[model samples]
Every structure is written in C-alpha cells, then in structure tokens.
Target: MPVISYELPDRFVAGAVGQPGERAFYLQARSGRRVTSVALEKFQVTLLAERLEELLDEVRRRGGDDAPVPAATPSELLDDEPLDQPVEEEFRVGTMALAWDPEGEQVVIEAQEATEGESAEPEVGDDDPAIAVLRVRITAAQARAFAERALKVVAAGRPPCPLCGNPLDTAGHVCPRQNGYLG
Candidate 1:
C-alpha cells in the first residue's frame, strides 16, 4: 500500500470543478510543492464534513474549555482558494476514516483508494501495494475550516426545487409535486 501522509500540511481543501450541476468534487492536500488530489462523490464530501464537526464537538465537550478544538473556524484559517492547478486525480476514494490524536492534538483523516473486492475495513500495516491511501493530520481549526468549505462546495451545486426539494436542472426538470410536469 502506498500512503501519502501530510502532517500539518501547508494547505488542504475540498473543491469542485466544472459548472454547478455538472461538477466533480475532490480533496486536495499539499505540503510545499507536493500535492495529492483524490476524487469522491459529493455526498461523501458532505458526510465527511458533518462527521468532522461532530467529532470536534465531542472533543470539545469532553475536554471542556482547555480543549484545543474551537467552537467555530477562525477567520484566518478559512480557505476559499480553488484547487491547485493541474488537478490530476491520483485515485477515487472509496472509504474514509477519521480520528482524533489526543497526544498530538490534531485531527487525522484517511481516504483510501477504491478497489473491487477489498475489505470494508482498512488493512492496518499491510503492504499490498495495490491500495493507496492519503492521510492528513491537521489542527482542529484547520479541520473546522475544511468542513465549512466542503459543505459550501456541496451546496454550491444546483439549486433545489421549491416544491419537491429535488435539484433543479438548468433546462428545468420534471417536478413530482407538479404531477410530473416539466417546471
């Protein structure tokens, strides 16, 4: 397995390319010049962001006021930059994991490459060479910023229909609430 690990990377962000309704989502991590980009579904990005927030909240609740976790992302930590140029995808992420490093006081995220017939759980310490993983360790502040950006990226897609709550297409769509009429 090839693991690309970044400990306190210079920058890490979730971004999308293409138009709103036809966008492709990616997670990019960078340290100096080395960069890694992995593609994943929009829903996966949403779940990752929500889970990160929940994890941080739990950490804050347990650790009280002394916890390194912040209730909200710091303004300086907010990242709104587009993805780095030449957004070459290294792999399509199938599974992801998150953990809190208490001693290091950082959030750990691992996105593993999708492969057919692979086990649901990651193979710890395995050197299969076929599996590729992107692991990043970032401060709680950075994690909060990442989640905020990811949610925004996901929400930046097509606007929802007023009646049915489904995404409205550029050419309009068959709205269920309108009895399948194109609205």
Candidate 2:
C-alpha cells in the first residue's frame, strides 16, 4: 500500500469544484511542495466533519479545561481558500478512519482508496499493495477549521425544496410532496 502522510501539514482542507448539483468534493493535504488530494462523496465529507467535531468535543470533555482542543476554530486558523490547483484526484476514498492522538494532541484522519468488491471491513495488518491511503495529522484547531469549511462546501450545493427537501435544480425539480409536480 502507498501511504501519503502529512504530519502537521501546512494546509489541510475539504473543498469542492464545479457548479452546485454537479460539484465534486475533495480532501486535500499539503506539506511543503508535496500535496495529496483524495476524492470522496459529499456525504462522506459531511460525516467526516461531524464526526471530527464530536471526537474533539469528547476529548475536551474528558481532558477538562487543560486540553489542547479548542471549543471553536481559532480565527487565525479559519481557512476559506479553495483547494490547491490542479485538483487531481489520487484515489476515490472507500473507507475513512479518524482518531485523536493523545500524545501528539492531534487529529489523525485516514482516507483509504476504494476497491471493487472489497470486503466491508478492512482486515487488520492486511497489506494490500493496490490500496492507497491519504493520512493527515492536524491540530485540534486545524481540524475544527477543516470541519467548518467542509460543512460550508457541502451546503453550497443546490438549494433544497421546502416541500420535499429534495435538491432544487436550476430549472426546478419534481418534488415528491407535490405529487411529482415541479416545485
């Protein structure tokens, strides 16, 4: 397996490209000149952000006020920049793992490449050379920034219909609550 690991990367973020409904989401990590971008579904990005927040909150609660984790993303750490240029996808993420490193006081995020017909659970210690992983280690503040940005990116998509909660297209969409009428 090829692992692209960034330890305390200079930049790590979630961003998207293209218009509203047609957008593609990506997770990017850059350290010095080396950059790694991984493709993933919008839902994946949303879940990652939500989970990261929950994880950080739990850590803070357990560690009390002395924890390095912050209640919010520090203003200086808030990154609103777009994904790095080229936006080349190294791999499509299949499974993702997140953890809080107590010793390093960092959040570790690992996105594993998706494989066709792969087992639901990744085997421990299974070295599959075909699989590629993008691993990024970032401070709690950085993680919070990333999550906040990711949620914004996801929300930037097409607006949802009030009737059915389905995304509305530029020309409108058929809403289930409206009996398939364009709403």
Model 2 lDDT, residue 75, Cα: 95
lDDT of 1 at 88: 99
lDDT of every predicted structure (CA atoms): 0.92, 0.89
lDDT per residue, candidate 2, 106-144, as tens digits?
A: 998888899887667653234467899887889999999
User: Which candidate gets the maximum TM-score versus the true structure?
Assistant: 2
- Would you estimate the TM-scores of all the predictions? 0.93, 0.94
List pairs with backbone clashes in candidate 1.
1-129
Error of 1 at 162 (Å): 2.6
Candidate 1 lDDT over 1-183, as tens digits, reads: 689889999999999999988899999999999999999999999999999999999999999999999999999998888999999999999888889999999999989899987666764334356789999999999999999999999998999999998999989999999999999
Q: Candidate 2, clashing residue pairs?
A: none
